[model samples]
Target: MKTTSSLSRILILVSALLMVSAYFTPLWQISLWAPQYPEGLNMKIWIDRLSGDVDIINGVNHYIGMKHIGQEMFPELQYLVYVFGAIIAFGVLAAILAKRWALYTYLLLLLILGLGVLVDMYLWGYDYGHNLDPSAAIKVPGMAYQPPLIGYKELLNFLAYSGPDTGGWILGASVLLAGLASFREFRAK
Candidate 1:
């Protein structure tokens, strides 16, 4: 029979690969698919495409300051970082806690994470423009999108603390994998 440690090692490798794959996706872009809730796409890539426009930065600033414009899409860049942090944390913590209790906890975390994101996205998907007459443009329908927490010091504080300690869990998982593998060698007995 395959040993517990051997299986754990393999699982750890698989988890790492899955996270890396998610990292390269255009989670930053909004599309017909992920533009709104339940199942939605990222919107940041869509903004990146317009980064070359001479007016984009000025436009983004206006929106962050609460100006009513489709340009509200910019500050949402914060979510890209948020989701990345979530994925890394869940992947490492759940992967390391691959034991019975840890397994359930990990699954619960996944379900909660997915639902949280879906709900958040759904609210964001509301589009007043879609239903309005041609001449009347409208703001989106959901929670008024707000400027992300701002200022240099505040931003740095979030990146360091609010971003989640995934790095710690990632290292912990790696060390556990190596230690477990070494302690319970996978060679044929």
Candidate 2:
């Protein structure tokens, strides 16, 4: 088996360490603006919790029949930390082994994990927006208030924006580093 270069191993270790910081920062953010609240309302999605104007956002969402926004609503938060921990551990193991195949496998895992996250978020948003209470106070026929996945969306009177947060950027960087490491290793021969 071909061995990865020392630099590739170092990069893999660094990528694993970078992923650790994701646990300490918010992974995603959503902001809402409306005529009633020009100041805007924001929500930050942390690894295991939610922050920012959660109560206010929930109150607004209630009028539209959307479920209350709460940490308890997201069961994924319970195991997200462990999932990342396992991925990071795998990266470390790949680095220690210093094998090209292992590094490539780590890179593939990162890509799949990233894609899975996006898909999961999209599905959650779809369910949250589409499954409205029948007796909602402000029901508009055939209207679903799904927030944009990565940009701005006008939901009734509210302008909603969704995007990655600090932790997300760090995770992207880790993936980039891992990819670079894999590329370097592949070309080393």
Candidate 3:
């Protein structure tokens, strides 16, 4: 009978546990700073909702013609909970089954899901930044307010910083652990 390595099993289990953190913590965060508001405005994006200064952010966005920020606006919020649950379930199964292919499949799915999220976020940002209403109050002749995918961007006087938050880092660590397990498994074979 073939058996999986103890390290691989442990890593998969740990990864599964870490993924649970995503549900409770914000996955991404964007902060805007200007001279007028020294403390800055923050927006946290979770798998299912938005938090932190949402009303203020929406008010500012209105002038620039960006869509009002709201949980109802995101369709993904409806299904992401189930998706993460499934990922966690699959990770646990992969560990318990101790099958190489099972772990590989989980890792592959995780990678695809991760990429999909980035694409979705970019599209969302693109739509908000580019589809400005003709009558917007704060129109710059050729300016778009698209937030950076993973860094800093300047929108007029505001400096926007975008990056993965705590949950995002956890998810990333989960993936890394899974990857390391896969690598070790492959090397052992």
lDDT values for all models:
0.38, 0.93, 0.91
Worst 10 residues of 2 by lDDT: 180-189
Which candidate tops lDDT?
A: 2
Give the per-residue lDDT digits (tens) of candidate 3, residues 1-189: 355699999999998889999889999998999898789999999989999988998988899888888988789988999999999999999999999998898899889989999998899888888988888888888889998989999999999998999999999999999999999998998
- C-alpha TM-score for every candidate: 0.40, 0.96, 0.97
Clashes (backbone N, CA, C under 3 Å), per candidate, total: 10, 0, 0
Report lDDT (Cα) of residue 140, candidate 3. Answer: 87
- Decide which is better by lDDT, 2 or 3: 2
186 Cα displacement, candidate 2 (Å)? 2.3
Candidate 1 C-alpha error for residue 87, in Å: 4.2
lDDT of 1 by residue, 1-189 (tens): 223354654664454444443334332222112112224222233212222222442333243233333445445554545655565576566555544344334445444654564455444433321222333233334423322211111111111011112332343354454345434443423
The candidate, 1 or 2, that scores higher on TM-score is 2
**Model 2 C-alpha lDDT versus the unseen true structure:** 0.93
At residue 189, what lDDT does model 3 achieve?
89
lDDT of 2 at 64: 90
For every candidate, C-alpha RMSD to the true structure in Å: 13.9, 1.1, 1.1
Please provide, for model 2 over 57-148, each residue's C-alpha lDDT reduced to its tens digit, 9 standing for 90 to 100: 99999999999888888898999999899999999999999988889999998999899989988998999999999899999999999888
